[model samples]
Target: MGYKAQFHPGTSDPSKNRKKYMDPAYKLQKIRSVSDEDVVRVLGHRQPGEDYKSVHPPLEEMGEPECPIRELVEPTPGAKAGDRIRYVQFTDSVYFAPISPYQRSWMYSYRYRGMDSGTLSGRHVVEARERDVEAIAKELIESETFDAARTGIRGRTVHGHALRLDENGIMFDAMQRYVFDKSTGEVKYVKDMVGEPVPAPISVGKPLSENELKTRTTIYRADGITIKQDAEVLQMVQNVHWERSFGGFEPFKEAKF
Candidate 1:
């Protein structure tokens, strides 16, 4: 039964005539013999995925296996050395992480990755000294407190505006931005002097009138300090002081005498 060959009307039974179809001598006769004359000429070489190997440049003459990887390019002619500007990709945002001298790649610590991934030197190390810097910066910003030595000052006469104090009193050179205060003598506000277009003193040559001075000076009770000169409008300001004006317009409700 297993060997019985059956014919359905037009079809020959494959089981009974298995040799007729399966024999290599007759079935694969098309590729049985190859000769220089019968050989098909392949115009171009077939690549890796092709089936039949060409005759002209036979499979035996094929070149070596190619590498799948590529090489990295070096920096440009004048490119800066450090990898400080390298960007790293993490979950979402592309973070700019500074590559430190010690480590060539991004830090591998999980804590570092969790904080701000892809930062070469983690946020903690990079930002370690920042708080101290910010604290000092805040102190400087608040130190805009008035200087008592500058009160009742006329044009170019206030200590803060003097080029060379006549009485050796504290002063700030309108030209140099240097403050000769008792605590910190010859203190140069370098930022103000070096910043673009350089900040100028608010009231150096122009004398503040009684009403102008009264209106110009505003006391901030929260800070317990008075702003003598309007840093916004004036340049080369000669008038500045710490002494509270006796009877001026009071703005703050929590102001204490």
Candidate 2:
């Protein structure tokens, strides 16, 4: 029998959320509605309805190098069309953000291909062929993984992952790419990801309540559930650590530590 895949092992909400985020088969819940035009607007990659700029001739026209590996591997749409590489970045809050930087990398690994991702203490970046990147960014921004106030779309000058949220309960951004609307109580992007001015404001929607953020957050804290609460998770972590340490020595020898 073929082996079935297991995403992660845990009983806690955060653990379950992690599994859900890292499962490719799981269709992330769409919690907000942002049009493709608006998504493009915030990214500032290309003008709306503009033809996708290409780096080279299409793979079919150019005739790729004759290699077995090339024949076996299917290229993504953007790659086939020779689209330029583009990037999108997100900064997640430490205080009950739905997903953190490390988890975002894991989620991207499971859910995407033909892309490169990097993680930092405060932010995560995904780079891929332009069209594919735009699609991925749009989905991520509108999905439940994103919270209007907690999740930031920043291409440069990533800040506010550790600082206290503003009075409106939104993460702080030195560039002021996004701002809170007092009347509508929604978050709007007046500037592009790199702090460039957009033609007009684009509303991302209202922020989630603090209670909602806690319930959806994947981060473990003293106030919320912790790893100590799940013995299976703790044991799995310890087992992996022990095995890695043991592997450092002879394979046949028993683990002493």
Candidate 3:
């Protein structure tokens, strides 16, 4: 008999979305298109036509290492080429953003290979080989999981996820990295992820509508869909809390909630 993985437990939209995003088998819906050049510009790690920098010589050229673990596991394209490690960080607004930092970490862990992810209160950061990070960034920017207004690609000074939105319904960025264009009603990035000025504006496309955001949002908010409404999720939360509180002292005692 084999054990199957249940990504998350709950029937609510947020729970279902969390599970979907964490499942590599589920295809993420592409909601917008950003050019590869634009992706590079936003990432600010290198120029559009610049060659990827390498940390070491290619794996094949290095030779001489015959380890059982190395033979069992296949290296990623970037790893094989020994590309330099790079990172992409995202800040998700609390106001019904499509996806939050915690879920972003979970999704990345399941979908990505040879990478590391960290989740903070307001943001998530993923580090991988340079080219691989760019590919991951582009996919996430175009996916339904990202909303231009509520989701920010910030490498540093990620401070707006918990703040109130601006007049145009865009998240408040301390760096003012992106702006809402009144003419096209689109959100454009005038600066790179780290607040460095870019040569041209990179349009990530228009923000999703309020209704659309609510539908796709993986966050459970009191104003939208409260966590209390999902019985199974609430039970799981309580159980986790109970285990954390008493498990250290009473390893054999049953949790009562």
* Most accurate candidate by TM-score: 3
Sort by lDDT, top down from the best: 3, 2, 1
Model 1's lDDT to the true fold?
0.23
Sort all candidates by TM-score, best to worst: 3, 2, 1
- List per-prediction Cα lDDT, in the order shown: 0.23, 0.91, 0.93
Which of the predicted structures, 2 or 3, would earn the higher lDDT when compared with the native?
A: 3
Candidate 1 ranges with C-alpha deviation above 4 Å: 1-131, 140-175, 178-195, 198-257
- Which runs of model 3 end up more than 4 angstroms from their true locations? 1-3
Residues 160-203 of candidate 3 have per-residue lDDT tens digits of 88889999999999999999999999999999999999999988
Q: Pick the candidate with the highest lDDT.
A: 3
TM-score of each: 0.15, 0.93, 0.97
Which 10-residue window in model 2 sums to the lowest lDDT? 248-257
Return the TM-score for candidate 1, rounded to 2 decimals: 0.15
* Location of the lowest summed lDDT over 10 successive residues in candidate 3: 246-255
Q: Write the per-residue lDDT of candidate 1 for residues 36-88, one digit (tens) a residue.
A: 11111110111223343222342224442453431233322112111111111
Give candidate 3's TM-score: 0.97
Q: How many residue pairs clash per model?
A: 18, 0, 0
Q: What is the lDDT of candidate 2?
A: 0.91
